[model samples]
Target chain A: MEEKDLVILCIKGNRSAQSELVGSFAPRLLSLIKRYQPKSLSPEDILQEVFIEIFRDLKAYNPEKGVLYTWMKTIAIRLILKTRRLDQSWLKDKTVPIEYSDAIPDLDQILNKMNTDDIMKLIIALPDGYREVFNLVAVEGCSHEECASLLQIAVGTSRSTLSRARQMLKEQYAQMKIY
Target chain B: MENNRKDWRDRLDQNESPMDMGMFWNSLESKIPVQNPGKKKRRFLFWLLFLLIGSGFIGTIIIFNKPKGKIAGQTEQQKNAGVTEARESSLSPIETQHAADEIPTSDATAVISQNQSSSAATAAGDSVHKALTKYQSENISSVTKTANTSDKKTGNNSNDTQIEETASSGNASPIKEVVSENKQDQVFGIENQNIEKNAMSTAHELAQNSMAAMEYLPTLSGELYRELNWNMGYVPTFDHAPKLNQEKSGWQYWMDLSYGIGMAQHAFKTSDPLTQSYLGNRSKYESTLESRLAVWENRLIHPSGFYVSSGLRYQTHITRFDWSKEEVKIEWKLADGFVQDAQGNQIAIRDSAWQQYREMREIRQHNTISSLDIPLNVGYIIRKKQFSIEIAAGVTANISQYTSGKQLNFQEQPVKWNATEELTYKKSNTGFGASAMFRASWYPTEYLGVFIQPSFHTDFSNRMNSGAGYEHKIDFVNIQAGVAFLLFREGR
Candidate 1:
C-alpha cells in the first residue's frame, strides 16, 4: 500500500498498518538515535517511544505538507534535541581541528560489502557534540546555518564542529582497520 | 559530506533494526484503553442515570403511599360526640338534660340493664348519653336545638359499641370509670326505679317528637331494643364528624395493556435543501403498536375524588414510516487506468462517490423502541355504586430507552448512501411529555376492578445527528384495558 494510505490506516488504528510502520522505519530511527541518545534507553524502547509519538500526532499530521518519512524523521530529531539540550555538553564543540586522511572509506562502499556494522560502531564511539553535528550535516543534509540554529550554536561553530567530527571518525575508522 | 548524505540515508533506509515486535505491540495494546477515553465516562453516565431514575421511583412510592385510619389528637372528641348523639336520639331533651345532671348514672344503669331485659338496654343508652353531655358541646347543642323533633329510636347498639370500645382500650379515660364508681353501690333496686322513669319519659317524648318530626320513631321507641337496633351506625353523618362519610383513601395497583398509534414528526435541521425538501413533513401518523406494562403504580386518592399516581411502565413501541421518496444510489470506485505500486497494492483511492445512479423507492420502514417510562398523573374519579369514571392529565419521562431497527441515517459521514444501506437508530433523550387519560372502571367483586383507559400521549425529543440535535416528536392515542388489584386500608 501507499505510505500515505498506511499512515491513514495507522491513524484509523489498523494493527497491520501500525506494525508495518514500525517495521519499515526502525533501522533509520535507530541510526538517528545512536547519533542522539544511544546509551539513555534500549533500542527497542526508543523505537516504541518514537512510533507512539508518530501515531498520537497523526491527527495533526498533514500528509499533503510533506512526505511521511520526512515528517517522522523531523519528529524523532526534535525529540532527541529536546532531551539532549538538558546536557549542554552535547552543544559544546570540544574537538580540535585535524588534517584529512585516507583511512576513512566511503560508508556507501562498506554497505555494498557483506556487512557494515563496524561503521555504525565507529559513529557511536564519537563524542555527543561531534556525532550530533555529523548526523545533521553528513547524514541529514541540513545546511550549516540550519544545524547551528537547531543545536543553538553559531554557523562557524557548526562548520568547525563538522570538520572536527569527520577527522575524529577518520581516526576511529583507521583504528578499526588496523584491528 | 553533502554527496555522502544520500548514501548514508540510503544505507540507513535499507538497514532493518532487530526488535521484539511481540513485546512492542503488547506494550502499545496495554494503552489501547487509554486511547478511547470516552468509554469510562459513558459507563459512569449510564450508572448515574440508573441511580437517579431508581431513587425517583422509590421516592414517589414512599411519598404517595401514606398510612391510613384515625385522626391524630381528635379521638377523645369523636368518642364523646358519638356517645352523645346516640343518647340524644333515644330520649327527650328534658329527660336527657335531667339524666346528664347526675354525674354517676351510667354505671348504675349499666348494672340495671345487665340484670334486666332489652327495655333496660334503652334506659342504659340514656345513661350513655348522660355520661357524655359534659364533653360534647357542639353535639349537645345540636341535640338541644333539635329537641322538639327528637323522636329517633333508642341507642342500644351505640351503648353496646361504647361498652365494647371502653372495654377494649387500655388507655380509656378515667372519667368513665369514675362515674361508674360513684354509682357502684346503687346497682339494683333504685336503678329499676330510675329505669322506669326513663322508660316512661322515653315514650312520652317519642309521642311528642314523632308528632313534630320523625313519625317512624313512635314504633321504634315503643318497643326499644326489639324494634330498633344498629341505628347509631348511621349517626356519624350528624354534621359533627362529616369526615366520617369521606370516600376510601388508599393506594391501588393496575396493570394496563395498551395499543396506540403514533403520528411521527420529523423536524430535520439541515442546510441540505434536498434533505429539507424530503424529511421535513409532519403529514401523517407512523403506524404504532405500543404495549404498556405498568408496574408498582400506586395511586393515592383523596376524599374529594382527586388522586396522584406515579409508576414505571415498560412500553414497547413499534412505529412505521410509510411513504415513498426518490433516492439516488452512490458508490465510491477507482477511475479507469489507475496505477498500482510495485507491491501490486492499489496506490490510489477514490476521494468521493463518482459512480452514481438514480432510483424511485418506497420506504415502508419500521423501528421498535422499548423504554422504561416514569409517568406522574393527577386525576379525579366520579365513582358509582358499581363503576367509576376517571379523568387525568400529567407529564411522563422516558428514563431508560433501548432502540432497534434501521432508518435513514442522515448522520453518516460524507452522507454516503447505497441502495441497500440501512443504519441502526440511536436512542435519544426525550424530555417530559404531555399526556391525558380517561379511565372507566367496573368492580364486579370487592378485591378486583376491571378498567379501560383511553389516552393521548405525546413524547418530545431531539433526534441527535453528529452532536447537533433536531426536533423529532411522536404523538399517539391509545386504549388500554386492565384489571386493578384494589387494596383498601381502614376508614373507607
Candidate 2:
C-alpha cells in the first residue's frame, strides 16, 4: 500500500501500520513534548501518551489539505501541553525566577558540561511563564505574533516575555558556569 | 465534504497528538475496545423501538386531523354558495329593511337634503359607479392588460385605486340623505325597481372585484390588509433597505478560542532573599478566549462582509523556579535503625541538619478577553477572469477588557487571587485597520455563486498602555481565508 493508504488503514484500526507509524514519529514528538514538559513527565511517558492520542484522533486527519507529518507534529505539540497541564502537582513547588543577562557560552565548557538532562532541568526550573514562552517561541519557532495570538496576549507582551525567558536562561548558564 | 475535512484537519492540528498513524491506531485500538455484537444488537433494538413509537404517534395525529380536511372542503363550498346567493338577490336585506328603519332618520336628513337637487342625487349615484368601475378595472388589469405591463408593474395599479376610493369616500356625506329618504318611504320603496336593479348589479360587481383582488396580493398582505396600507402587496415595495452613505470594501473577521502553552516573564525583588520566598511565582490561568467581528465592503458580493465572534484557547505548561533557602532543624526515621548525624550520610535519625532548599512551581495561565469591534472598510474591487480582488482598509474601533486569576499553591493548598484589569497591551485609539482580499467566484449556475476569499487586516494603533505601571507597544494583524455560498445575485 502507498504511505497515505497505509496511514488511512492505520487510522482505521489496522494494527501493523499503526505500530510502524508510532515508531516512525515517536522520537521527535517525544523530544518536542519533553521540551515543553520536562519535570512533570519523562520523555518516555509523554511519547506513549502522544501515540495513544494520535491513534484516537486518526480518523480526523485529512490528506487533501496538508502533509501528514506536519499534521501529526502539531497534534503532538498540543497533546503534550494538554496532558501535562492536567498534572499540576508541580505548581505547588515552584523555583525562583532567574535573573536576566546577555553572554556567550564557552564552547569547550559547554560541550563537556551540559547534557540534555541538565538543559531540561534548567528549562523546567524557569518560572512557569518564562518556560512556556520559551518553548512556544524559541523552541517551537513560532513567530512572536503567532505566539501572542496563541497565548492571547498582546504582541509586545509576547515579545518581551520571550526575550526575558531567553535572558533568564543565559543568566542560569552563567551562574552554573556551563558556558 | 471538502470543507468539512478541511475544518476537521484544522481542529485536528489544534487538538490531536503527534504520532505516526501506525502507532496511533494501535494505541487507540488498545485503549478503546471494539463493541460487542450483543451490545450492538441491543442498541439497534432501542433505536428501532424509538422510531416505531415516534412514527406511530405522528400517524395517530395525522389521522385525527384528517377530519379537518373534509371540513375545509365543506366550508369552501358554503362560501361559494353564500357568494352566489348574494350576487343573485336583487337587494340586500339592509336595503329592504331600510324603509322600516328610516322614518325618523329621514325626517331629519330629507328635510335637510330636499334643498339639494334630485339630479344631484343621480349624479352622486353615477359617481359611486364610476368609483366601483375604476376599482374593478385596475383589479383585473393584469388578466386583461398583460401585453402592456409585467406582473409587478401592473400589481401597483390596485393600490392606486384603493387610494382614490378612500379619497372619494371622504367626499360623499350627501348620499346618506337619499338613502334615509328611501328608508322612510315604506310602501313607496317599489317605485324605482330599475334603480334598485342597477344598485344590485353594482354590489355584485364589487363583490367579484374584491375576490379577484384577493388572489393577486402576496401572502404577507393578509395581515397588512388590516393594518398599514390597507391594500395587498403595497408595503413590500418599500421594505427596510438602508443604503450605504458611502462606498465600502469586502472584509472578513475571526474570533478564535485557542489554548496553547506559552510563558510569562516578570521580575520581582525581595527585601531579603534568604527570608522571603516566591514558591513558584508562575501563575496558571486557563479558559482564555478572544473574540473579533468585522465587516468589509466593495470587492466581494457584500462589498464587505461583516462578522464578529469569540472563542477560547488553552495551553499546558510546567514552569518551575526556586524560591528561598532556609536553614533549620530536621528529624527523620532511618531504615538502618541507628541514631546518628543526618547530614553526614550515615544517620538514621538526627535532631537537625542543613541542606540546599529549593521550591519548584508550575503555573497554567488562561486568559480570556472579550472584545467588541466595529470596522468600517473602504476598498476597491478588481475582477480578473474567474478571480476577483478587493483591497480595503478599515478602522476597527475596539473596546476590550480582561480578567485573570492566579493561584499560588504551597504543599497543594490553593491560594487564589483574582484581578480584573483592562489589558492595555495594545494601542487604544480610533484604531486604523486595513484589509486586502483576493476572492475567486465560480458561477456554475445563474442563481448560485461559489466563492473563496482570503483576507488580511492589521490595526495601526498598536500601543498598549497599562495605566502607569506596565505598557506594551505592538502591532496587531488579522488574517482570514474562507469560502462562502452565495444564494441569489442581481444579474440573471
Best by TM-score: 1
lDDT of each residue in A106-172, candidate 2, tens digit only: 4223423455555655565566556766667655557777665444456766666665666666666
Best candidate according to DockQ: 1
Distance (Å) between predicted and true CA of B262, model 2?
43
Candidate 1 residue pairs in backbone clash: none
lDDT by residue (tens digit), candidate 2, B1-492: 334323422332233234354544455455532211111112243334335534544464355346444434533443223222332344422122222232233222111121223223223333333333454466534322111112122112322211001011223211111111223231111012133333333433433344332322221111111111111111111123222212443322222221222122223232221111121121111121222322322123343333222222111122222222112212332211223233211223322222211122222333333334555555444433333343444555555423332332222223332332222232333344343333434434322334443333334444333432222222222223333333222311
- Cα error, candidate 2, residue B352 (Å): 27
Off by over 4 Å in 1: A1-179, B1-248, B253-274, B280-290, B323-360, B406-424, B465-471, B487-491
Best by lDDT: 1
Candidate 2 chain B, run of 10 with poorest lDDT: B160-169
Once fitted onto the true fold, the runs of candidate 2 whose alpha carbons sit more than 4 angstroms away are A1-3, A42-45, A64-66, A83-128, A148-161, A172-179, B1-29, B32-492
Q: DockQ of all candidates, in order?
A: 0.06, 0.04
* CAPRI level of candidate 1: incorrect
